[model samples]
Target: MAKYKQLFLMGLLLAIVSCEQPSPPATAEAGKVAFNITSYLQQQRQMLETRQPMVLKSVATQGQEPEVVETPDIDWEDELAVFEQADLSRPSLQEFYTRQEQVLEDGSTAIEFTKLEGANPQVQYLRLVMSPEGKLKQLHARLEDKNIIFFSRRTINLSTNPQTGDIADYHVEGVQKMVLGDTLRYEVKANL
Candidate 1:
């Protein structure tokens, strides 16, 4: 009788353990998010091929005083090519497979990726914000190069026409620190 009671308890424990829910495949979901972001960027690239040049302002400062100097407008005709040349490669995409996805309070979605495997292995993070329909809305990236003790950040915000799905306007801001012992900052805002 005692042996039978022990067997019953073991069976109950096994049943409860088997009924527990399993975790979702995070990597696969992250990959899907990354693919969506890449597709949206590709669409933007195609649109940029036919758009006119954009206006930009640049500034630079050195040392700790943080003097802000605003420069005149500059034509940014080659920025699209620069973005394309980055070549969202396979390894970089793999990094996104480990990212986290969340929905913001404003009903937008955000995907964030971090690569801090080592002190010098591109200690960086990429955050992408998109609309519910998967349109790219904003992108922010921070990258650190430990070898040279350099840091850089880029922020881009875009608005699109609801009916036509065309870009209405965009603003881009960038900063680089300790780049060959100099600091630089730039901002670009354009209307389509």
Candidate 2:
């Protein structure tokens, strides 16, 4: 009788263990990265800080002459922040954009990401040109945001020195319109 009781308890324990629910599957999709734009920009920022290169900046607005300046003391982070906003590597945005890659005739690689239909992302398009050695040659992005009262759109282009992998020039052009105020158009270009 005692032997029978021990066998019953063992069978009961096995049954309970077998009935436990299985653990959920790992999230493989969340780990996918189209491009690590944020990390790349951060690295560029650090390099620029160390080099402290002088920038020849030009700014122009509607109905106004362009203003140009050359200075070594400027906020690199702030200047680069606009590019950072186009980063699409966030987990939440993984499904919002589609990526395409191709090799150009000059042996460079072009990777582009475009927003999918019905997906309202701030960055509508992004393209990156990489050299044969996998160095960034150029970057371009278009961003747009609209609300009931205001609308804004910006296009950014950045070029890097092939030999040194440093930013050689960049341009930012945008338009802003308010419900009750005049439309504003501006352009900013910087050469390093």
Candidate 3:
């Protein structure tokens, strides 16, 4: 019967529509970001393994994500507290790298960066603090002396060699905050 045939076709259509797969979270734009993050991570790991002072990155991030997306919340001051307790007497420099961890959606992620031995002089180091959604909370960088400086730019990022003044394209607010010693603490937020 025509009525039965129509019902069968409708059911088939519904089934097909419902079978469609959801889009991947890692889109083309996100893919580019993932590539950059992976590259940075690899380079950081290499530096840690080799005990090298990473060339200061000139900028922060270059992402394809829409500018309107909500910036994730971060508590940079607390993040900095961790580095304050950094163990200077650790046997190897990489030991500092190993102590770094960031919370991801599923579990947690570890970030690596290059640190020069006594050449840089500050015992404390920089590391990435993260939110549960894999967004960066704060950025940690080493200062030449035994102190670290931080700024309260809630939704900003920096990418330049403060000492050398080499400019890199970092998408952030340019408000400087004083952090003494050899560590530089930055509050990296999701928003601009």
Candidate 4:
């Protein structure tokens, strides 16, 4: 009987550590997660819930034109911005929109944006988008409420850092952090 009690206590202790919940998965709706996606991608200020690579893939469908997904080979200096009011609020739609890359980034691309709306101007949102070609696309947003100034005043940025001397491909990391508010930071690092 004493042995049984000791075994029970040991089991309980094991459960406490092993059953610790993993961080929450990041969603495209808001840049938030419960866990880290990877150790290398982890950060002191933020954690990656997801990482996606960028690769154009063809779609096969019946009774339709063969969808040959091709990211236009653009000259970094010549490709004029073809989109107006292009928004990253919608993961899929924004992915489609960015398909016409002014330049091919690394295996993956990350973007952040603030001041998003759901059809109505009054509705505001925020998200950090991650696109991994052929695998998965991800997004994360903060716990937000509509009809507030925080949604409209926050700023977001997306920038790419090209490897010196080589511009065709590079790494991308950006954050959609709101000053004083819940700052959702997103950044990634990968070996070449």
Candidate 5:
């Protein structure tokens, strides 16, 4: 009877210790779980800086006529910064999105990441298409931010030259609304 009591006490202590053990920290899996948007944009910025591509830019705000300009002196980093918002490689976001890959009928591959229901990530949807030769051909993303005082929704679309891997054209359009203020609409497009 004494031995049985000792064994039971030992089992209870073991169970308590096991239950109190800390869990391991979450980590992103090795090897490209998601497309590295920031790296791609950095490469694009470097290439643009060296080559100084001509850009045709158009901007419109609040229902006004779009003003267009052709220039080579534009700031590449500032222009491409918005696209970086779609990056989902953060460890905290690893489980918040659902990723899917499908091959298109045109011999291209499409990969997408979408925010799961009940997740409050700002980037709701992101899609990337690659050509048969594994070159990025297009990218699209939808982002939104809302609070008691301000709300904004933006959609970004980008097309690239598959062979050269250069940005061919890109568009960003959005709407913003503030509490007790008029809503504003804006659009920006650039062709390189």
Candidate 6:
């Protein structure tokens, strides 16, 4: 009985530590950059919730004809909902630092984050570039298995509404190669 109670308490503690919620930024630039990520995620989530229609173009790496599907016919909300959750506070991001101050010709900054130790699936690193006002301009992420041959990378470039700082159009490109399988490549471009 005592052992059972101790085990339950330990499990609860682990869950609490693992589920730490994200906090807002502490500095002006950091806050703006973080806010951009949060806002973009929230917008994506809202789009999913509202079931906004989109045209998705998918093609194989072997140069097959792209398959264009208008989204209301095939619900893609379940897939896009995942991106709505992208935030600076995800457990996978650790030791974020300002790697470069002038990533853009206009004197914007780029922040880099090292993957957390023992992070599941192993992310190599993540980078976010932002405008002076803290609007996100681009994001890049790489994932790799050092012990094996699997590797993947994703990049997102966004254009925002100057007045609202909301994403106006964005492009996402990614490539993945599994340890025991063929490589896959995909790209998405959407405007709002």
RMSD of each: 9.9, 5.2, 20.8, 17.6, 5.3, 9.7
Candidate 5 regions exceeding 4 Å error are 1-32
Tens digits of per-residue lDDT, candidate 1, 1-192, equal 999999999999999999999876555754353534345556765665656435333333333343333332323345443233222334544553246789999787887767645433342566766777766666555443433577776555555665445556555566777856776776655565
What does the lDDT come to for candidate 4?
0.32
List lDDT for all candidates, in order: 0.56, 0.88, 0.38, 0.32, 0.88, 0.57
Model 5, 71-93: lDDT tens digits are 99989899999899988867567
Error of 4 at 63 (Å): 52
Model 4: CA > 4 A from native: 1-106, 109-151, 164-192
**lDDT at 90, model 2:** 77
Error of 5 at 127 (Å): 0.8
**Regarding TM-score, does 2 or 4 come out ahead?**
2
Misplaced by over 4 Å in model 6 are 1-39, 47-60, 70-87, 90-92, 96-98, 103-125, 131-133, 145-151
The estimated TM-scores of all candidates read: 0.52, 0.80, 0.23, 0.19, 0.80, 0.51
Task: Say what the RMSD of model 1 is.
Answer: 9.9
**lDDT, candidate 4, 1-192, per-residue tens:** 999999999999998999899765354433322112222122211211122223243433334454544443322221211111223434433322212121126465444443434344321333333334322133233222234334322222222223221112222222333446764433322221
lDDT, residue 9, candidate 6 = 100
Q: Mind giving the per-residue lDDT tens digits that candidate 2 earns over 1-192?
A: 999999999999999999999865355433446566678789989988988888899999999999999988778889999998888877678578777889999999898888999998899999989889878899999999999999999999999999976789999999999999999999999999
Residue-level lDDT tens digits of model 6 in 55-165: 453433435665555454434445443243334554324334332344667777777665455554444555677778877666655544344777766654555565555
* Per-prediction backbone clash count: 0, 0, 16, 14, 0, 0
User: Ten residues in a row with the worst lDDT in model 3?
Assistant: 29-38
